[model samples]
Target: MSRLSLHRRLAFYGAAAILLALAAAAMGLTWLFGTHVERRAIAEMEVQLEQVLSGLTIAGGRLTADKLPMDPRYSRPYGGRYWQVQKGGETLRSRSLWDETLSIDGESAPSGDVRIYRQRGPGGTPVLGIERTVRLPATLRGGEAKLTVAMDASELTEARKAFALDLAPSLVLLAALLIGAQLAQQVYGLRPLKQIGRRVSDLRTGRASRMGADWPDEMRPLTNEIDALIEERAADIERARFRAGDLAHGLKTPLQALLGEANRLSEKGDEAAASAIESVADSMLTHVNRELARTRMAARQSGTQARANLAEVAGRVVAVVKRTPDGARLEWTVEAADDLVAVIDPADLAEAIGALAENAARYAEKAVRISARRAKSKLTIRVCDDGPGIPDEDLMRVLERGRRLDEGSVGEGLGLAIATDIAEAARGRLTLEPGKEGLCAVLELTAAGT
Candidate 1:
């Protein structure tokens, strides 16, 4: 599965919460409106019941309404409006009741107070009603009677449905606006993180040395820590380079003294002892040079705004190599464009390339070629020679320090190992492959402006 970004996660959760809240609001509004409609309906029924009670009279010893309620629905069958009166085994109902009646409990309510109820009405539909039991006027034959007026409960239900339908679009629009505002807030909040990322990239590429100040308050602690770490790392690398230089210089004098002793042994006619001492001194010198080179290369890698021209470095190495006896016997070709550049220190680039080119010139039978090209964000420098290349299995072993395939060679086997270390320090690599004629040494480096 793909990872979700911070913005996407925040948007998802925010939208969900907004929708839930709006849905709840919609439900609550619809319920409140339904309760309001029911209350108004019951209040209207109370007024109708009062009118029916006021119009009642005793004629011929029977109860009769001299006047009925004013609503026209009272005259229509099942029109959702109704009235009923009952006294001493007599019952009177509005025409809207038709042959049906409002179901009522046998227990009578308290006098002079109206009570609300819910029960099946005409045609088995539910209705909401108000009831009052009162004593008739003394002049109209004093007796108790129950009066009820009801309206169909379905009216309140329909009113609630209508209210929800009307509210849905507004609720949807509100949710959308809220969600949009939340997304904008999240983007604004996370902008600092993006800026920090770009600044860190600049630091790595040597465009900037430190994470500067004036960050948001929430991000100050983090930025300050990163700046401190970068400073400490640079200081540490500088100190290491100083120590390495001191160690190398201090050992050089002793190595020279050993060489002087070897020469004296040779003068004394002890050739084998002089040869052994010379070999040991040479080996120690080689190790010192290799470490010193590695330290400097690592310092360059830490952070340096240095750009080296590929063509220039290649030409310099070629000119130096051509002065050697083996290079004089071979043809050297340089095939790099002058504009091609890499993000590496000029001296470091020259040293790495010179090591490869010198090795190639030493072994080439006819010709040595130096070429470079930029591919995407990488700059590759290739040095090839027209000589017998090493076997595939021995390619990796040859890069190891002091591991020489041919011990008869004059120099210690540190050239290829030093070149490899330089490449690694610069976040690159060196690889050996079979060329069209013989061996190919490829140095891959980071291209400038990548």
Candidate 2:
């Protein structure tokens, strides 16, 4: 049955407990009924014993029994009532004994007081028998005689069997009803979990940006926290976009003046020097364009949510870097499983890691290595290169905006800074340290939810 669901399992347990209680109740009632039946049978036998005793009298110095007032129905064979009297060897019996004489099994019957015993009747029905002995007056024989009374108890057994038969079906029906009610209650109780699943699905398909606040008390806090994270990401993206635009606007006038001066020098001849100046201006424009592109990319991805597979991203970045002129000569290796995922924008993660790979390709003598692992709630990505390591004093300063360790190098001044900015916006951190062989850059971000 694939095991019962939580609701059905609880219902089954409840029904089992109820059935146990019902069984206990049935047993108690049956015990009480048997006790009542036994007491009634004994009482009836005592009454018959008293009637038979009353019939005894003494007359003419002889003991004799007068006409007894017992019901005639009790005299019939197998009629469930009987009586007998014995004086020495002489015996007299009621017709209800049906040719079966009552045997005196006790050593001697007690006088006046009645005693009860169980014996089998002619028809094999269990019977309750009461016996008594009494002495005659002096005028009579002055000896004792025994009298016995019995009644069939087979009817009491039949009544008990019928009672159990009547109760069995009722207990079964009650158990079934209780089990059904428990299952229904469980289904209703879990309805909120189902609603939460649907809301998450809506968020995944972009139908909703946030799971708004109208939820059950148990789920409200979780939903509110998710909404707050979405809002925070949106604000970070907006701020990055504004900064990029402002930086671009602030640099336009100076770039224009540089181009105008280069153009004026070209018009005055000395063509070779003019060409050199134009090249510098063009290089400046190219670097500005790359910076603007990086900023726009970062801004557009502000609220871009994705599960970044660490190994896949690293592998893809390495493949692209391997195609570059300098990257082609460097050995690349990735060490992480594909299932490791981080909850961050994939493009931002790639760009951050890609900047580290580019730096490695530029300085590494032989190999560039990447490794990723999950620690507690965070995922850490490390890129290492077998190149001249950064000086300890410059490690932290290297990530500052517009700073470059090699001032003679062109068109690569802000790579680390731009990557670090993207990581910061996603609530991640970046670090640079001396590797075993050379240099290592580490990026840390939150792990994705399964």
Candidate 3:
């Protein structure tokens, strides 16, 4: 789905709300004006009825109404007000009625006072008729009957129209002011979001390393998270670059030694000895390739992830080793919890644990013990064996690159050194310590915060 821009959405919603409020206010004003006009028209009509009633009289047993005092407003023809009177089905209307007779619908009203509504005259003007049954001096009672007084309502219609016209401009002005205020509020509220976008762009262009934590409280968590991700990616890249350079440097000497040996063998003119030397050089090259692979793996695995579980890695390594002839006869015990984790890559941790397990299998009488525990921010994994432990003097020496205590062992002296190098790159340490009954190797890595 396509997304609407924030500014446009804000403007739209603001306009809608303002329009709704204005419409409600306009309706309310219209209603109130209409009510006031109606009340005033009724009051004027009531006054006209009273005047017409006062003018009533009976002369010679014939009822008659003289020219009543009228409002100046209804003096002209169709000037918006008019009056009419009816007696015994005969009607008398103002000149303002314009030669049209007043027509009232419904039956004749009852005695006392009654109000009858009608539309009358040529213009079909609204009329309110007030009727009174009169007993005129007993002598005229048989001849004269009821009387009605009415006034036209055209003035109220004009007043209502005028009110609408006058109120329209004010309502429109209020709506405009409200819309402007809403727009201003939207701009002010979104200023912080705009700033955040600009800062993100700056980071992409390398103009800034982080969005400094000076943002509003609502935005602080987002800024901090972005900074953390950037820092983590930078650290990963730096470690990869260093690992590549170090691996290249480490391989150069072995490759040079192999080339030198080949050159020497070619000059000696001893075919069998030269063949043996070539085999040794090939083996050294193979070992160098393995170490190079290990370095690459280590570099790829470095990240700001939670640590690998030491007990889990040790169990996996031992399971694999159990298939081997020497490993089949050995006993392994892992004392760490399954949930225990360290701040190291799982693959790197597995490799380190594998190396220690294999070494223990090679030299141990029967059993090897792997344990993990946390101290402060560091997690330590110790691998102990029931075989002859290293002497105190050589314990530190065994950790050196290409140095092995047992010269009789096959393969290049790289397993321990490779594991140790990986640990160091991960900001960890590996050390050899004298065990109670054998050698104890300890791998210490930082623990990720819970």
Candidate 4:
């Protein structure tokens, strides 16, 4: 039922309709052929009846036919052709009838008028018959004689069977051609829908911007509606992203003022109050940064074409981190191939890698290593640090926004959380695992050109 595709459904219905029509056609043709055969048989019998009437004579006061029909069957007994003439209790019949006779109904009719009927003949087989009552001339004692000529009805039946057999192969061939044409029509008709499906997939993957207008008249309205919906959805997302950016920017000045107040408190020698104010300001700023990262990820997800070289983005993050105080003291290694590219915005990729690199720099006792590789359809970037790694139980907890294992760390603990959001938006993932001598952050994103 419903599981059948449109092509299959159309093929089924078309083939069924063709078969039914052909079946009806076969029957109609067979019937017409049978009617034609019967008419031809009756016409021949009419000619024989006329010949029988013309040959009628009274010889030795008995009715007899002096001239016989030319067909050879009339000379053979039970040859399926017959003629008879009867008048005044005297009867004359063709030799083909032998001692048997045709059975006719006793219905009366006008003289010289011919009638056609179905009745039993010699050997009790069915026969198609033509009969007439003819008036005798006055030279002889005037009287009317009934004449009949018949052939076996089975011959007509056999002819019809033969005709159908002859017609079968041609009809079957016609049905095949018709069904093939129907399937071809279905494939041609549905090709547009397949193209629409592929185009819609391209839109989802940021490969195409619109559904386009090159469609059949029947499909134009549907494609137009889909394109309109896509435009409306994109407009709505753009507005929402703008509002989010405005809100994040609005909160930034307040958080900076709070930090400024904290610095004044420190100058006034209120150390405890300054530390508390700075903590609150840093925490609020972290939240704002997290929101901005989310807004960027959302915009990337809304069908923006994005491709970033893994090596380039990783190099940028490492170079920036190297300038930090903690990063300058640690040995840093970057091991990414230049050819490896990921399907994500270059800016988003840089920010995500920066978060991981900064965390590695802050905690590494001796070394921080960044490496990337491309495998089939995915890009894997790993940032490893030779530092005390978090326990397995706390690994999942660290990815939650604002959750930190150590309160003394300068970061407010949104780095991994923001990175995770960006990875998921790119149809990838972020995972943390224990490396040989430290924590390893693995960021997997979709590979470009895959």
Candidate 5:
């Protein structure tokens, strides 16, 4: 399933909640309006009932409407308002009745009591009726009679429908405006997160060193923490580099002392003893240098990245290697795109690639080649030499410190190991493979942005 963005998810759920609330409110309002209209209609019927009762009279044990109600509709035929009086089986109806009758019978209306209900009337019109029982004058009959006043209920129903029709459009417009405003609020609220992302990118690319201030209070704690972390990291890297340099310099004196003692033995004509002591001292010095180089590389990797030109770093290494005794007899070729860049410190990158290029030049019989390229997020550097390449079985071993394939090799086999350590600390890798004519040493790093 595809994921919905924050704005979409909030908008969808918020809109749904609003719609539900409006629907319920619309229903409640419709019902209230209908109920109010009904109550008002009942009040109006009560007035008509009073008028009808006040106009009644009794003569010779019979009921009479000497005067009718004042409502004009009651005088007209099929009028929406009507009245009736009933005693024993005889009936008196309004002229508006027009041969149709109100159904106010079969229910008790005790003396001085009034009742209100709904019934069909003249012309099958839905109507509300109020009925009351009254006592005849003592001068005439000795019983009670029923008088009812009714008004059409269809008009009330029609009014309710019209109210809903008018209300629908206004509610629809309100819903649209509310949902639009909510979406705008979400975009405005989430903009801070976007700002954080761009700032962090700038930090990684060396364009910015810290997350600046003036952020909203909600984001201030986070931004402050990130700024502090970057500062602490920079300080830690600097301290590590200083310690590595100091350690290397401190060990140099002791190793030189060992060499000096070996020279004294050689002067005394004990050549075999001198050679053994000198070889051991030289191996220890090489190992110390390799370890120090790795320590410095690790420190650099923890700090902010700097954009380094792949071609520039490789070219400097090749130029220096060409001046060496082994490279002087070989044809050296260096190739790289001028614009190729990697997310690595320039000095660290030079040290790593320089080791590989130097090894290639030292072993090559006829030629040495160095090349570099940037492809998307990956930057690749290769050093190839026309040398007696290590056999496939020994290629992996060559990457381990002090594991020389040829015991007679001049230096401790720590060059490739140091390069591998540097590459791995930089979040990259180094691999050695046999090429068409020699061994090709591959160094791959992540490229910086354009």
Candidate 6:
């Protein structure tokens, strides 16, 4: 039922997008890093394999070597780097292999070509290596031999693990930074909207008649449209008021002529029929006036945004109503905040409160209490009496036009009904409930904010 805030929604979506992107980036970076580390290990092993092969030659149909790789790891058993050569079922291996043998799957590769693969090493650790076949010069017997250089694959795996460990914190930090930046962007991008809201509030409180300038290009059109709508609404209300006045005047002339005719009949010795005619004419007049008042209240409520001090209006109503015979006999207590203002026309509010105060004055046994205060978006004015309270079912009926709970009481029946219409026109309501000793009438209206 309420308009949701745009800033909060945008922030949520922006953060979600950043989080998903960071997640994808994290996964992609990890994949590329692992692939690179594995390839680098294989390339290094291939170079070592070439070095090991350079030192090998066939002599008397037996494999021989001039020198082995100088790396200290090769001389140490299970030192994590190894090389091996094989020819005609004869085998040669670096000292690093110790008693372990390199197991090749015999994947077919042309001579002088290199193949890369992985295998388990000492302690069942994973190993990455490159293997190649070379053609020996026919110096002894022309033959092909296989040479392989391998280092523990765990090294590359550990490097990738370490890289991920290091990158995780950085990516998390980057996500935080990006999210923070997104928050700032949201604030900056939406600041204009905040300004527009304040200006619109000013319009509602009667501080400004129209939206101000200096808006961003993106929002300027909206502000212009809102200003136009306010102006249009005002014009419509003005014309409505004018039409209502003309119609009420036109109807009042005929009703007054009818009442005059009844008086003439009464003067001519037809007392009973003339009295009935007068009563009917009076009832018709009440209806016309009630409808007219309601229409005028509506036009006034919508025609302008005006703030009225509740304390001042209450004081004025009390001053005028207490002069009556019924109100003068009873004590009156009024409580109102001096600075509290409501978004309603002063005359309209006065008329509404006057109705409640007059009603309380008529029924209160000993005293009447009137209080006004504002909370959040609403301003409440409550009038209570010390007389007998009305029944629950009669509460709503009493506010209907021309419906009186006590027919013997001397009064027009439009007080509560008109007050109810006035409250509704101002986008509020009137609730009649049982008070401690009597009926309480509460008129709630939209409060004005400075």
The candidates, ranked best first by TM-score, are 4, 1, 5, 6, 3, 2
Estimate candidate 2's alpha-carbon lDDT, on a 0 to 1 scale: 0.77
Tens-place lDDT per residue, model 2, 1-450, is: 666775556666777887788889888888788778878877877776677767766656445656654677466787877888888776667777878887646665557777777778767878777788778555546678788887776777777788888878987787678767766776787787787788776565343557888788889898988788778877887788788778878888887787788778888976777777777877777578657757665564546455678888898899999999879999899999877888766767787788889988888999999999988768888999999989999999998877888888655466788678767766688999999999999988877752
Better of 2 and 5 by TM-score: 5
Off by over 4 Å in 5: 1-12, 35-217, 300-302, 328-332, 390-397, 433-436
- Model 4, 287-386: lDDT tens digits are 7778787876776576445688988888888888889898989998999988998888898899899999888887899999999988887889999999
Best by lDDT: 1
> Who wins the TM-score comparison?
4
On lDDT, who's better, 5 or 6?
6
Kindly report which residue stretches of model 6 are placed more than 4 angstroms away from their true locations once superposed.
Answer: 1-23, 57-63, 120-125, 137-143, 175-243, 260-279, 296-342, 346-411, 427-447
Quote the positional error of residue 132 for candidate 6 in Å: 2.4
Query: Candidate 5, after superposition: displacement of residue 393 in Å?
Result: 5.8
What stretches of model 2 exceed 4 Å from their correct place? 1-3, 58-64, 67-69, 104-114, 133-142, 168-450
User: lDDT scores for all predictions?
Assistant: 0.87, 0.77, 0.73, 0.86, 0.83, 0.84
Which scores higher on TM-score, 3 or 4? 4
RMSD of each: 4.8, 13.9, 16.1, 3.6, 5.9, 6.7
Worst 10 residues of 6 by lDDT: 297-306
Error of 5 at 278 (Å): 3.2
TM-score of 6: 0.65
TM-scores of the models, in the order given: 0.75, 0.44, 0.47, 0.83, 0.71, 0.65
| Worst ten in a row by lDDT for model 5 | 136-145
Tens-digit lDDT track for model 3 on 389-430? 888999878888778888988656677887787787667889
